[model samples]
Target: MSNSLFQPITLGHLTLKNRIVMPPMTRSRASQPGDVANELMATYYAQRAGAGLIVSEGTQISPLGKGYAWTPGIYTPAQIAGWRQVTDAVHREGGVMFVQLWHVGRVTNPDNTGGAQPISASAVKAENVKVFVDNGTDAPGFVDVVAPREMTKADIQQVIAEYRQSALNAIEAGFDGIELHAANGYLINQFIDSESNHRTDEYGGSLENRLRFLDEVVGALVNAIGAERVGVRLAPFTTLNGTVDADPQTTYTAAAALLNRHKIVYLHIAEVDWDDAPDTPMTFKQAIRAQFDGVLIYAGRYFTQQDQAAKAELAIASGLADMIGFGRPFVANPDLPVRLAQGFPVATHDPDTLFGGGEKGLTDYPVYQAAK
Candidate 1:
């Protein structure tokens, strides 16, 4: 039987050895204050080099875009120098890593953003969602989430410039390519959500207007990094951040159709994960495929059932998604491909170290020696 998970995938000019992708996961362990990418980050990623592709954690473009002080960035000289070492290490271990560029939008608190007010699609504050303040424990100088400053026409254009510049920085820092983080409840998403965006400006109202910022930024990224090396991740209309959109299907379909037109290297959709989805999931597989000729990678929480994997393979084989991602299982079992191949029970991930932590759950997960 052909190992679908281990099969090769052609992502534009780049050829992945397997379909397994270590999608961008924020470790939140960068050295504090400056949030420099140290040797630890490099070693952590090198351990996962067996995957076909590895997308690094969300890296901020400029100082203002940083929501968490501990996360890494691609802007500063010291940061670039630090990340260069990480890229060099991953390359030495036979890995291809792309930096996921992000702008936090209104999620930022003024206290953490170097005194700058958090900016979003509108001046609306996020309710019910709890953002990580300073730290999880001890003193934890956290504050209630506040509404963000609505960006002016000039601010919107400047943000796009940041995306382009960030792509340039990623290439110079020795990354394989760039992934525009239009997912999560971040800045791009704020602009995409109808409830969050309530302006009569050019960037609000209709789906085309809402998609304008993302389109401009993505177009700028392609211009900087080339279409062959650029990719995008979208969350559609669903909200994991305690916020919901009025019409998700209309939102995601329009976004997917517009993105597919770019012919990017791939579109990593935040597809169905939860069974009790209050908002019905939109299957843009046909729509996206009709519009795009590149790859489609679907992710967001899945199990390793043989029947499930087989069904997924059939869908991929039948042209639904080119690649499927397994997050938690892979986090615990570094040899997830091998375990799945042998139909062995997958190891459980340590919930303790899933977020902020040391090497215990980060790189200490033992691989099946036989696979080695």
Candidate 2:
């Protein structure tokens, strides 16, 4: 059977050669002292340019937005110049790339932010959640998240301004588009989830109010970069990082309707992939599609060529999704699209060096070679 995974698709004004996408996965390899992208990061992305579209790892929009150590940021001029190297490398290989703007909200400890308190939609803490941080000691490791201060109206406005500025910075760095990191229980997700948000202001309480932050940020990004060049990611059913909503279907469906009004480029769904993780029902998928009429992307644990190819084909053929994003697969298989298409053997990646590391696991993954 001929699969539609290799077919071309048009997203806004950008035409993707295939449906395979390289979604963002934090490598935590940014340069120290400045937390800026570097030539090593550029080489890593260039090696995986075989994907139809590449979404860079979650990049903090400002110093205060950072949660994990060594992740890249977009606020400083040095950081902007560093990211330019990455964008240039991907473009030289004829690949379209988007930077995922991020703010970790309460998903951090004071150790990671130079003693600054983490802020979120409310003062509530994410129970049992741990964040990787450097305590100015020997090595960096995981630490339990602390309670965050409730964001004031002024704080809210400043974050929105930062998002707008980050969008402009992304353009300055020569990216094809921008993908807001509203998923994975991050800053935006904290506001959207009822369990994490307990405010009575205009930015919380009712469902519409909770979505206000997302709406404002998206509007700002769309205004700065145009709706056609912007995308938003959501994790409706994911409980990762202590995010929980009373009714995910209702909440996320309403979110889809709201985003439909903006007519953004696409909606990327980050499906839960952990072992024994609950499956995303078709009802939710249908509800979201009914409300938002745009390209849809789904990313999860699909790895094998046989399974992923079949899933991708079914998704596009049935109008359920227009693209499929492969995360961990791209970590080991830089030329994953070619390997999947040609039935080549894929390499395994080391989980130990998945986060902060040097060139060993970052750029040393070998491309597929035929057995002689």
Candidate 3:
């Protein structure tokens, strides 16, 4: 049973150290006023370079894309310089990394960007939302989420360009690739949900029409970089925080089919875990596999290895996900693949301070090297 964890896997152009991938986890440590990555954030990412592939935290694509306080962005020159530090460190350690480009859509408050209203596919807002407000270089406050202006055709085209520009910026900052934040209740997801997107134009009504925004953004990223350099994330049926989708099976199936048409890189899907029910309808790792012949990754709340979980391989070995992402397990054990290979006991993850804080529960977590 000596299955290898140090074996290399070719994911498009990047060759990972092993098959392990560090999933995108938001750590709100961006320097204030401009949301630039800092020395602390750089060193923090470097500490976990043992991962075969590191998908850096969800980074804002523009000022309008940010929803939370202290989240890093890739739009500014300073922010690009800051991310360069992070990418350099990860590269120095022989790890491949990708940047997840994000836009919050209606999930934002005007307070975060000096009273700029959030923009969404439609003029709808999440029932309950919170966002960070910058008072000075040091003081950022969290406030209520306000309704966003419904995007006009001009806004749509402008945001697509913003995505293209941000992708170019990510390359300049030394990212090997890019992942679109089309999941959660963010911009792309807002458009995907029939309940959220109530537009009457070409961008709404049917599945194909509703999928126009993602199509445009992804196409722009592919044009900026290349189709082989772009990947996307989706949370098919998440009912989180009063967010609802009409039919997840129809939603994700059509989405998967649509994604197959484009020459993109990979698709990462998350099954929601609300009230203990599966989030993605269809679990069509099989259906998606039948549709798109590309790399697939799946992650959610379930991460245990007792008997290796029969249902786990239903995605990976059974042809749904080419690779699997371990979130909580990776958070606790930096040397996760190593421990998993040897069947070593995993370190317990701390429940407190998952967000909004210092490095106490963050980068200070030691790898097995230090544990020895």
On residues 45-146, what C-alpha lDDT tens digit does candidate 1 reach at each position?
877777778888999887778776467888877888889989998899788888899888877676667878888888988886655556545223445567
How far off is model 3, as Cα RMSD?
2.6
Worst 10-residue lDDT window, candidate 1: 133-142
Tell me the tens digit of each residue's lDDT in model 2 across 287-372: 88889998899998666555645666677788888899988889988999998888777777888878886888889999998889
CA deviation > 4 Å runs, candidate 2: 135-139, 305-308
lDDT of 3 by residue, 1-372 (tens): 334334567778777776556788877888776888887777777777777777888999888888877899999999999999999988887778899999888887777655798898888878876666554443346677888899999999988999999999999999999999889888999898889899998999898888888888887888889988888998876755345678877778778778777867788886664446744545455677787767777777545566432344444555556666667777667667667666677777787655556676677777675354
Count of clashes in candidate 1: 0
Please list the C-alpha lDDT of all candidates, in the order they appear. Answer: 0.77, 0.90, 0.78
Candidate 3 TM-score, true structure as reference: 0.91
Clash pairs (backbone) in predicted model 1? none
Off by over 4 Å in 3: 1-7, 132-142, 279-283, 305-314, 369-372
Identify the candidate with maximal lDDT: 2
Better by TM-score, candidate 2 or 1? 2
Per-prediction TM-score:
0.91, 0.97, 0.91
